[model samples]
Target: MNKNLIRRTAIVAAAGAASLVLAACGSSDDTSAGQSTPSAVSSAPAAQGQHNAADVAFAKGMIPHHRQAVEMADLAPTRAESAEAKKLADEIKKAQDPEIQTLSGWLTSWGEQVPAEGAMDHSAHGMAGMMTAEEMDKLKDSSGKAFDTAFMEMMIRHHEGAVAMAKTEKADGAFPDAQTMADAIIISQTAEITRMNSLLGKN
Candidate 1:
């Protein structure tokens, strides 16, 4: 071939190769971008999950409520005259301490502020059936059968409050774990209430 014709053919061949490479790169980039957008969107809802005001209230209110139950249970070992009461106290503390952790963890996962540990200020939490300072003081001062009676009465009321809160959560909360916990509280506390009533009968 002539030198001029050879040079023109080489230029055309190089241009065609460059165009194919550019088109292939753009196709790959477009495919990657298209794949990424749906993945990011699909993951967002799963990450958020189902959270609401009721779940927040349940966790916030119940943590302190459980703490108070633990505190009251601590008094049982020394002050309770009834063996039944002491045993029940141990049960209460065991169940509630871990529950406090579970509830706190939920609050953390939900991006809600967890209640500070050791703070039992439940006033204005819309929590029902909490004992007043005087009532707790009254229980602290009592001992023997008197202590047993007071403790049973107070705990029954306390459990009733917990049941009520759980019922509200079941009705209003959006989180599945929170609702499950709420159902559990209602069942367990109601049974405990029946047992407490029987304990009171012994006194």
Candidate 2:
């Protein structure tokens, strides 16, 4: 071949190789961006459940226990004497009422039998820190400082029970959501218990 023709052929081959290299680099970048897609999904909130027996038990037990707390909180608006006492009661209700619904929703979503609608019929299984009929009656009957003291005493007991249950869920439960909720309960109720203890003049 002529010298000019040979040089032109060489130039054509070099251009093709450069095009292939550029295409390969583009493919590598696409793969790297695709790798990040999974990370984005992982950062999303976890799926709600894969609940185990311990999680169900925690939910069933805590709901009634929380309901009683709400009932007790409701009484505080009328019966509790101290502004601090009443405010605590209101805060308890605010925190627990939504938690009650969240727990019940999880149970239902898991195809578990939610506890009986009201008052947590603990007939089948007893929950910790439940108020006795007599105790609840006394709380309802008492007013002013008497009510304030009774409510705080009872609630401290209630919160202690919740913290215990939450700790168990953290240890034994399988569901991510349940365990997270349990952790939150342990943190919040522990603080509330401390506050109530101070209010009651206890160590």
lDDT against the true structure, per candidate, is 0.86, 0.86
| Candidate 2 clashes between residue pairs 3 or more apart in a chain or in different chains | none
In Å, residue 73's CA in model 1 sits off its true spot by: 0.4
TM-score of each prediction? 0.73, 0.76
Query: Model 1 clash pairs?
Result: none
Best-performing candidate as measured by TM-score: 2
TM-score for predicted model 2 compared with the true structure: 0.76
> For candidate 2, what is the lDDT?
0.86
Q: Counting only residues 3 or more apart in sequence or on different chains, how many pairs clash (N, Cα, C under 3 Å) in candidate 2?
A: 0
The count of backbone overlaps in candidate 1 is 0
> On residues 31-146, what C-alpha lDDT tens digit does candidate 2 reach at each position?
77655654565555555446789999899998888888999999998898999999999999999999999999998998998888674464523566778888889999999999
Model 1, span 53-139: residue lDDT tens: 999999999988998889889998889888999999999999999999999999888788888877666463456877777888998
